[model samples]
Target: MSTKTPFKAIIIGGGPVGLTFAQCFSAAGLDFTLLERRETVTPEEGAGIAISPTTFRIYDQLGLLDAINKIATPIPQKHVMTKDGHRYNSYEFHLRECHGRPMAFVHRHELLTMLHSTLSDDAKSKIQTNKSIASIVSTDHGVEVTCDDGSVISGSIVIGADGVHSKTRRLMNDLSGHEEPVFETTFQGMFGNFPRAANVEEGSQMEPGHDWEVHSDKISSQCFVGRERGWFIIYRPLAPGPTRERKTYTEEDVQAFAKDLIEMDLHLTDKVKFADVFKVVNKAGMTQLQEGAVLKRSFQRIVLAGDACNKITPNVGLGYNNGVVDVVYLTNALKKLVEDAGQTEIRTETIEELFARYQEDRRALSETVDSAARRVIRTVTHSDFVKYVLDRWVNPVLGLDKVYGTKVMGPLLAKQQVLEWLGEKNYLPGKIPWVHRGLVAGEVKA
Candidate 1:
């Protein structure tokens, strides 16, 4: 089959998930144009990304595994410690052994740069930088995206890979005549960075091969160590603020926040407390993290993915991974129309059914992941008695790979019609396969 798209896919956002969508579409023989608000594909946003075995499959499909591995670190153990620097619980990072892949950690920028680089020349040509979308209109058989620059581009499908504050979603809600948007809740989190963690001895002094965390009474903190740079994340329960509110922080506010947390009793290494590590912090911020999936994922020709539809708390790094899988699911759905249209033609009447199926296929998974991330925040940040139970038996028993975590990725891919049609045999082999279905690369059907 010729690798070319018959009907164009207009992708909004040039972040990792949007770029991943372009790769999938290009590989699937679909044509697309990507519009990004940033000046370049590699945006300096986010940090301490956690990649699961499932995500590796997505990378393999996108043809960028070798490039990704260069800047990535496999997390072999998840070290749990006390503020006094005593190791209380250390669990073997056995996903690599059990699922054929280790949970990898990389700086957000490194992963995004590699993802953006993976695009073929043809795919690269589709990208338009600094083209921030101002509004979107759903037409009879297509959607028109208006940019802040007053230019409008129309396509058969419009996808939103924008972050939680998604303009596409808002436009979609307005065009549908719905007074309220689908999203509702958000959480508060504090994050800091440690540039010198790469110099610390692994296992003996700081942590194992991955990130580590030490909990304080009101604040819980975690740090991810990569090859060159590392990140510190602090999740603080909010004091009952209104949901879905946007927030901005001054550098002083972020510094003061980190100082207050560091001033508390949290330890990582003998030479460096987590506080000492924050003194020369490179980047940090406080944001109201959204935690709801849009009530509906698709509105006529416009569809949403990633944080645009579902933004969860980042306790276990669920949001970005889900965003990658979303590309697969959307690709599978779009491929059906492409295959049916004999490549380029689509039936307007069938359009609703096609997008509705995509929503049905993804909504449950989004809700599940959103619930699980929230559950983790509750579990790890519980009161004294609850934390004691979790620290002692509950967490150690459950381990790192939660029920819907990595253990389910391989099968998830098996369910996608695209990968299954392609007969991708390289997916991480799951123990119990999906009988009639399979992995969304895993977060998918099996």
Candidate 2:
């Protein structure tokens, strides 16, 4: 990589993480392109995303925070309730302190539109829709990508931002002769608007908090407020059943799922009927978050980011935030490398050093997130004893002092500093650690 190198980087995906990476690359004066299989940016029916403060910070950095605020609903609280009209645990947070802004809920489509609108004409031109990448070939000089259309594009570096089923990952596996990826579990999710029944409104008006409701019958319902949509999430154990066996759901099945959900909530059962509400069903096939290294170390010019690399459970709502931070750290690291290369000599050795830094910095954080997310998912989806403790003991205690308070991030942020240091050889850009990086870096052991 040289100042006059005119490096061409291809990002294979146009989702939030890929788009954000494109923005950062463009801002850094790099020649980059993004590819997406989807041709349009619009809200998919029945889907919602919870925007955490860390994610808000990334949007703010990209100058889209206000736009997000305009379209999203600020959720200051989460409520947990029981199936039979009893409250379990409630957690409330003031998002301003957690990530220097408030958390919000937005429709998935609206968010895509906001991000897509921010792309420059050059960046937009670089995005090719409906062009799915079929394979990636890394040569001595550059990386060549083959798309479904049989067209080939080559670049100095290739990034696989292509979601969980990444073609780039497959290519890397082929290059390395690794075992086939194994998926551990499948998740089903549905999103739909419920008519604001009087009871629903009353439930919404209750003290602001993250709510979890557990029923004696071994089911749980979690509800969160979105800007214009009220979101209801139900998680049940995946068992062998006719409902679980169906690969795709019919309209009637979706309607029935909604009816059953509403009926399960004693608070809303009498207030609304399945036929009275509008809803949409969204489902994702089982996906594996890749584990272990595909190569001996991070490749010199190739790397994976976001879902392309790891898939954590949505229980923590950190997927988007963590992905955004990946871009942030990668961009800053590359910027530093660029500046250093301009001042001194650049070599393959220097590039390798940077890649090592990336792997060192990101791997542990990724593993930590993976571990924490799985723990939460197991707690929520398995073990009746754990759920009982949460419903019976944790809920009451949380309600008394706002268990999910704005201060929730203090400990998390502190831990993140340690992880970032392990990955980046320094603390996150803005934070000041009690110990110097030089002292801690040695302790981190690369």
Candidate 3:
């Protein structure tokens, strides 16, 4: 006799998205397992994450609102200024209107710890760390997953919550004969905790004293005042060097890079010291985000979520939140299907159709967000006349608060508006936008 598997859903990855999915599955009373390749929940180092209102709403549902509220610091205003320190435009987030909570800044690891701690002991037992997935096979009955340890597990459904470099994605692509994904470029970042200088406000720009100048061309820096850690600063090279071999940088190398950046910039010299910072330079890259039709033979039983399916630029910080929403819609769809099939077993066709709806609902939202984020990048990076006008004149006059707040940021907060837009555009069922289709067809593959 064959052995029976015990899980209703199997989540690949234990990162924030995967953890959030596990929580949702657990709440729904589904037997699930979350497998993570890493050994621990804490990040290797301290990195900042901005939690938008949409993300906060989801956190609220997960009963983590108070925990995050107590620890996270709010951002009262964001100023877009010139290299010489002239304020071009500014926008202040209306904290009260944003899901009855404020936009927050917190250490990434702390946030993950809070989420992980919330899991019930029974649910916590379901998480398996240091188990790397090797392959996935979609069969007539269910999905079979093979791990690096040679262990085999089966579940009725599999969620590829694994990130951008997902093995789940590779398995699906190989099974489908889809074209390989192309990598766009990479970003190098260095961050460290700094003592709160005397003059900095609760939520303001980081300057040595009341008067400070920031070098625009060399470095891009942001500071946040936290509850416990006091203050932290992150400085990124605006024009990162070309993509080279991935190699770990030592503390000495990081310090040297920091010193060079400060020296080259001149404007940041007095504000920060090489001795007071800890830095790491990691290659962060983007891939062209695309997905096949859910009805396609390739997409029959497999589904992709989060960065695995649609990778977005990080300008608006919606990547993780959007992925959570993907899980929300996907699980809700599965729940509805299970209810509809009450007395009878759910058919593969019904599952496929539900996933199709999920693709449609999520794809359009992803495209809109991706477009806006890329536009922001292009606008900020541009030295062209038209872009200058839009960034300087148009943005300030129209109010970036209204433009970004109403157009891009608003949808994340308002689900009805998003759903309405997706419904009207018929984005469900994985319909490719004509423009995107054309671009992908012509672009060189990496």
- For this target, which candidate reaches the highest TM-score against the unseen true structure? 1
Q: Tens digits of per-residue lDDT for model 3 on 236-260?
A: 4334443423345566765666666
Clashes of 2: 17
Candidate 2 structure lDDT: 0.57
Q: What is the C-alpha lDDT of each candidate?
A: 0.70, 0.57, 0.57
Worst 10 residues of 2 by lDDT: 284-293
Residue 417 of model 1, lDDT score: 36
Clashing residue pairs in candidate 3 are 360-428, 360-429
- What is candidate 1's TM-score against the reference? 0.87
Candidate order by decreasing TM-score: 1, 2, 3
Q: What root-mean-square deviation over C-alphas does model 2 reach?
A: 6.6
Model 3: how far residue 180 lies from native, Å: 3.6
In the range 1-446, model 1's lDDT, one tens digit per residue, is 33333588889998878988887888788888899998998867656688876677667655567887888878766777666666667766655665567788887877778877777777888899999999887765677888999999888788999888888888888888766644444346777555655444444334436667765455666777666666777776666743555667677877777676667746654335666666656777787766777767777888889988888888867688888778887787777667777854465556777778878887656766777777766655654677657664666667644444445533443343334334344665544343332334445332
